[model samples]
Target: MALDIYPAIDLKEGRAVRLFKGDMQSATIYGEALEFAKMFEDMGAKWLHIVDLDGAFAGIPQNLKCIEEILRTTHLQIQIGGGIRDEERIKLYVDMGVSRIILGSIATKNWEFVKTMARSYPVAVGIDARNGKVATQGWAKESDMYSGALAEKFVGSAVQAIICTDINRDGALSGINISFTQDIASRSGIYTIASGGFASSGELKILDENPYISGVIIGKAFYEGKINLKEAFALFEK
Candidate 1:
């Protein structure tokens, strides 16, 4: 399968930023959210992965204006997560033209809600794992449920995809956790997108060879210049 590349624009305080190990204090502001979305579109990105940092922490959508601007101005298909705990919020995003809605903390707490949403709208389960366990509340809290076990619950569901992130490597540029991602894909029996710590073409090559991984989220690597998006796209396109 062709690997889809989703250039990530994590929004903190209505600005594009990258957080270290999911830490809010470690946010390194890049620039305006619209500018980043435009840049990714110009670079041939088909999809954009957005996370509302403030929303995730506040349990409410805080960056609606910024998010709406990006959606209106850019043609990039957006799959957004953060602060989406209820159906009303999901409807709000969907009405705004968001292609996919990602349920993170809520997915860990309510599998039935996720399944119900997936049946009606495009939904992706955001499984942020720390130390092989599921992390929630914007990674501020860890749950006893194993990541794979959580993923397994979605098996045979209507979920559009599973976005699995390794909290330890996210924004740290340590590297993509291949085995961990593959395990989620296998357990979920759904298309899985590997997120966090994507830093090189070598890692992309590795993911390209993995049949289970259907996509990846590129964040810090793109912002820090660890990997060239154009070159990575070329490699994948070839």
Candidate 2:
């Protein structure tokens, strides 16, 4: 049950912005994407979670400029999500040396596309939900699908992991939705990455014991100076 914490570098309008509940309009740019990524790397984080905010909302590929900058700069294992809907987009990221390509919107909408991607790439499935119902189209829309039901779709494939994010808790700095996250992992045997509403290391300490939980992605807490990545790494090192 080793826990891996991925400091998030979410790019919105080519700058780093941690959005509340995945809201794009209510965001504040904090720094350049490359500099931010470097800071996370400096903290001894071996993996980076990078998201293209615009690409996620527009349903089109954006932020390749910043992504390329990250690829050129860091040797860390990079897992990229957002606007990755088709085979070409998946190929583009893999060709650029992205370690894992996350399929979100397309995985919920097009079964054939998801199947094709699992067959062709090192892909991951992201289930972003609000109150247990899945959301898509950049978290602007919700669906009737439960997170567990969705995980059943990737039973056997190249789907390396499932990133389950509680949309209501994202960027809120309230608390990690542990019960919901743990429930999904318990029911589904796939490796799970917890996302959204992680406000402190104490919350992570609780999660560290869960063998089903493979990783957690930190965004607002990391930006707000709540969770110290360096200390987190040190704690895990011990």
Candidate 3:
């Protein structure tokens, strides 16, 4: 499978931002949402991964306008996560042209809801864990459950993908946790998307060598000039 490159557009206050290790307080603002989305599309990005930081912390979506504008304007297949807890918001965004929805906080607390949605729509679950245990509520609360087995729960749920993040590596741009990422996908038997600490296109060659990894989410790495968009696309492009 081709390694899909996802340009992340994490929304903090209706603008693009990236949080260090999922810390809300450590967010680095990146500017307006629309302009960034168009830039990724122009650079040949196949997918856009958006996280609503406000929504993730507040337990409800707060960046609908920003999300909607990107959906209405871009040709990118976007996967939206954060602050998405109930069905009304899910239906609303799906109607707004979201290609897929990512279930995070609720996916851990309500497997039935995640299972239900995965069956009816294209959905992925994010297991944001630090040291193998799951973290919820924007990574502010940590759980005792192991990350790999937690993702395994979706085996027969028809889930499109399982996106796992090593919270410690997120936004550090040190590099991706390749072995850790592959373990999650292998144990779950699902298409996995690896996130956190992606540094360069050189790492893409390493990730592409592994079959379990279906995609990689690049954030600070892309914005910081550590990884160039064209070079990244060239490595992963089919």
Which candidate number has the best lDDT? 1
lDDT for position 157 in model 1 = 98
What is the TM-score (0 to 1) of candidate 2? Answer: 0.95
- lDDT against the true structure, per candidate, is 0.92, 0.85, 0.88
Question: How large an RMSD does model 3 have?
Answer: 1.1
Model 3 segments more than 4 A misplaced: none
lDDT of 3 by residue, 141-168 (tens): 9887888878878877788988999999
Model 1: clashing residue pairs? none
Greater-TM-score candidate between 1 and 3:
1
Instruction: Write one digit per residue (lDDT tens) for candidate 2, span 1-238.
Output: 3698888988886788888888888896888989988888888888899888889888877899888988899888899998888788899999999999889988788756786777778888888999888899889988888777787777765678889999999999888788778777776577889999999888887889877788899998988899888989877753
Better structure of 1 and 2 per lDDT:
1
Ranking by TM-score: 1, 3, 2
**Model 1, position 58: C-alpha lDDT score:** 92
Residue 174 shift from truth in candidate 2, angstroms:
1.5
Residue 35, candidate 3: Cα error in Å is 0.9
The model with the greatest TM-score is 1
- Look at candidate 3 and give me any clashing residue pairs: none
C-alpha RMSD for every candidate: 1.1, 1.4, 1.1
For all predicted structures, in order, the TM-scores are 0.98, 0.95, 0.97
